[model samples]
Target: MNTLEQLRAGALSGARRLTLRADLRELPEEVYTLADSLEELDLSGNALDDLPADLPRLHRLRVIFCSNNRFARLPEVLGRCKSLEMVGFKANHISDVPAAALPPRLRWLILTDNRIEALPDELGRRARLQKVALAGNRLTALPATMAGCERLELLRISANQFEGLPDWLLTLPRLTWLAHGGNPFSAAQEAEALDNAPMPRVNWADLQVQALLGEGASGHIHRAARADGTAVALKVFKGEVTSDGLPGTELAACLQAGAHPHLIPATGRLSGHPGGADGLLMPLIPPRFRTLAGPPSLASCTRDVYDPALQMAPGAALRLATGMADALAHLHARALTHGDFYAHNMLHDGDGEGRLGDFGAASFLASVPPQQAARLKALDVRALGCLLEELGPRCAQHADAVQVLADACLAAAVDTRPAAHDVAQRLRRLALPCG
Candidate 1:
């Protein structure tokens, strides 16, 4: 019963961004009539099968979220919105996504949890496209033209029918994040085999346990050195730490997959320790823990490490920060989130380089609630901010670098925070700024 004039006035007077998911079953005529001035719109979690045809008239619109709907076809009007950059149609009934249907300037397109069988060649040819989330679909193959998307960084196609990943996708110059594990079209056989793989045997006597590196409510970390003189950090997890077995497994998997130069890669697992405890063996970081002075406080070790002044050259600080950023980006690209990202968990190799050391809290986006996942990201951002603050006056010398770090740490909201890849890019730029 709402009038167009009333709706238009309400939209104009109210918030420029409108979310009309509640108390609405169908697209009200008044809603579309007021679209001209709208900059952002979210109609997700609704029962609509199709969008209002007049959506293209919203020349100023930038973001549109229609996920969790009943739409079976691509919205034809989207191509007309010149200003449109982000479109989220996840959890919809969409089966086909016409390449030409998307706007040229579209930067983010999320079609996860849909019926999409394949993407149009032109979809990947768009130069401005940066992120695409198409997980939980039926895609058997990716368009070859996707190679043309020079700026694309994230491509998530998990839970699909792929037998093998597209070679081109693996070779993407800018594509850093890729998650296609669950797809039958990719390496399903390998992944399945890994799930049932036997655990490696461990000889406790052969491994010399050094000083206690860290401790948590659920586990304790010790610096262990093998007889061969190979040193590694051993994270011994108490059996009763978490009721959920999947998170623990995922944490181990992510660390194992990550072998970056600056990342504390997981070497293998260690089970059947004293008291029937389980643990993981990772590369031993340098003895000098730059983030902390002596040992961490009970509170700090239980949570995360936060140290401000370790006193290092400006170049060393820059290298450490940049390396950490790169490692985080690598994890993010894999659609994995380090739920516990803090200074204590990060270890500096003493050569001005750093590595992400803990994976006990890592998880995949599809496995965790979006809201909860967002909170984890927010925590990481807060930690990043705290780390910058701890850097103190040294940060002032590199104002531009510090600004980028600050922005990543102090974004208005979790969703607004820069992606790990973007954070790494900003760090790289700030590392070498013009006078």
Candidate 2:
């Protein structure tokens, strides 16, 4: 949290990265002093509405975060930064993104919670692009030119006005994760899911948070006790759009997913926060469980990183795969897609007792045409295939059946992958492992 005072005092002279959260409305002149050394600059949570031409003078800058501001336009000066590759302007009022503002080296872009009605055609010209977070925008359709983003992998277009997903999106060659809930097409279906759910809704004041359990891109989880003294894990959502989508939509998906033995036991959402913040209540995860793998780093981009020394036996791997497959099938039955399905969203007891959680990136599939729905579900199959592929090296030898099934799940032709129900059934019929 470097301050203007610290920068002016020359205390941060050699810093490579800088972050300032002191209600700045404009760029500080002192910031240019370290342009030669700065690679990242974070001025998020400020009152800024615009950027200065001098901002581009930070020639070595590779990343910039100006979220939670009042900007109505993306500064054109950004287009001049030679080294800039990652840009985040989350929660801003930005409605205009000039084609000239995007750097050629750009790989990641986040514009969640903005008023963007349309994206420039040049967006597709950035062939190096990989991750794009465009949730909560006004976009009715993506520029057709984006079909050329062959290197693209993860995308979040949730809470937008798209009536149908672009057909070319499924053929992007590398797209794996997608979140598209809370849009006009899915509004009625999402409403139906919420209304039909038998989830218990509790008043906010009835709960008392005891300790923080964890936090994610969208919310904070805590260990809490209800008015009746029942122990529960509470997830209080941040009141804004996230890299995934809206918090309310996530809460609804969690409620609609209902119960599955292989899924975290969620009770449902609670109402009546003093500030009207939405929250989800669930049976506390047991201490024996832990996340299966670490989240992706900047270099790995979208792939989860696992422990290099970790190992698994064939039987254990089979058990884990079966459990996850069952959970997916359960969600499939509910017409929901766990778009963010990954090792980072999984928990295990290290003995094959695993649970699938996190609906922040989940979406409803009932609103799309059957062809689109098939594509959505097939995307999940690819995710499952990725999970199974990770299980391969963990064992002394790849289970032939698992490997073959993985190959089928990962069929380059999106529609060729088997459905989740069939995958689960097949996993059950596999012979007992040698271990």
Candidate 3:
């Protein structure tokens, strides 16, 4: 939220990253002064409809975010920036995406909540592409050319018009995280999910909201007390389409997931919100609980990050893995895929006890054909494999056994990957020996 006055005053001369949110109608001319050092730019929350044709003058720029703006099309100048790799234009009216608008080195592209109906074949030509967010758009089909992006690991195509998924999408060797719910093909199943969940309505009047606990991409969480004086965590949706999908779609998926020991126990559905916002009620996490790991970095692209010095006993490592495996199995039994299955979503105490949270990227599996569902399941297993690999050497002992299971989850043949139930069962067996 830096003011334009500071930028224009040359106060940020040596800044490598600049963010200005002053309702700018166009790129500030002062930005060019930092062309030699600027590496990132954030011009979100403005009224901008376009970027200058010579925006590439920022030769050192590598990332740019222009979300919540008025662009009707992606700026073609973006492709000309030789160092640019990350581009975000979420929540715009963008429809046409010219082939010339995709940079050759593009790795991460965020075009969520737009009106795009088709993607240029050139999108596939970016060999470095890894993460793509295209949810909340009008896309009916994806270009077949995208099959060549061998390094792609994460994709979000939910809440779009897609009638079905393509075969190549399932076989992507590196694609471990995905979401495709709330589309034409899955709308009926989404409705079924909303209707079939046995959730209780928790009236907003029954609770007293307290201090904010945390905020995420789609909502704010607050600590609250129920009518019975019991503490609970209340998550109120922002009621907007996020890069992952609609908040309402995510809320439905969580209700459908029900309750499990390894999952954050969602006790009731939030109702009678004065603001008309969708939300959920769950047991409040204690202060001792914290995220097991951090989300991906610009360099990691799709992998969660753990402390380099992180070390655990053989039993602790096995216990953590087993609990997560149990959560994954529970989710799959209900035909749900936790699309963003990373350590960052796993909350744990100092010990091995943990629960998987965050349904923002979860997708229903009931709608996809059996073959496609199988592939998606394999994708889930691959995510588990990555987690296992991430924690492999961190275990003081039994690292070999952990990697053995990881290799099985990461098997190249989709159909050959072990089922979620089997993975959980195997982990339970592995933990018994270490204990």
Name the best candidate (by lDDT): 3
Error of 1 at 102 (Å): 1.4
**Could you list the CA RMSD of all candidates, in the order they appear?**
13.7, 2.6, 1.6
- Alpha carbon deviation, residue 167, candidate 2 (Å): 2.0
- Cα-based TM-score, every candidate: 0.53, 0.90, 0.96
lDDT of 1 by residue, 167-191 (tens): 4553344443344445443243334
Query: Which regions of candidate 1 fall more than 4 Å away from where they truly are?
Result: 1-14, 185-252, 255-435
Evaluate model 1: give its lDDT. 0.62
> By the lDDT metric, which is better: model 1 or model 2?
2
lDDT against the true structure, per candidate, is: 0.62, 0.86, 0.88
- Which pairs clash in model 3? none
TM-score of 2: 0.90
The better-scoring model by TM-score among 1 and 2 is 2
Q: TM-score: which candidate is best?
A: 3
lDDT, residue 12, model 3: 91
lDDT at position 170, candidate 1: 39
lDDT of 2 at 245: 86
The TM-score of predicted model 1 comes to: 0.53
Worst 10 residues of 3 by lDDT: 308-317
After TM-score superposition, what is the CA distance of residue 29 in candidate 1 from its true location, in Å?
A: 2.4
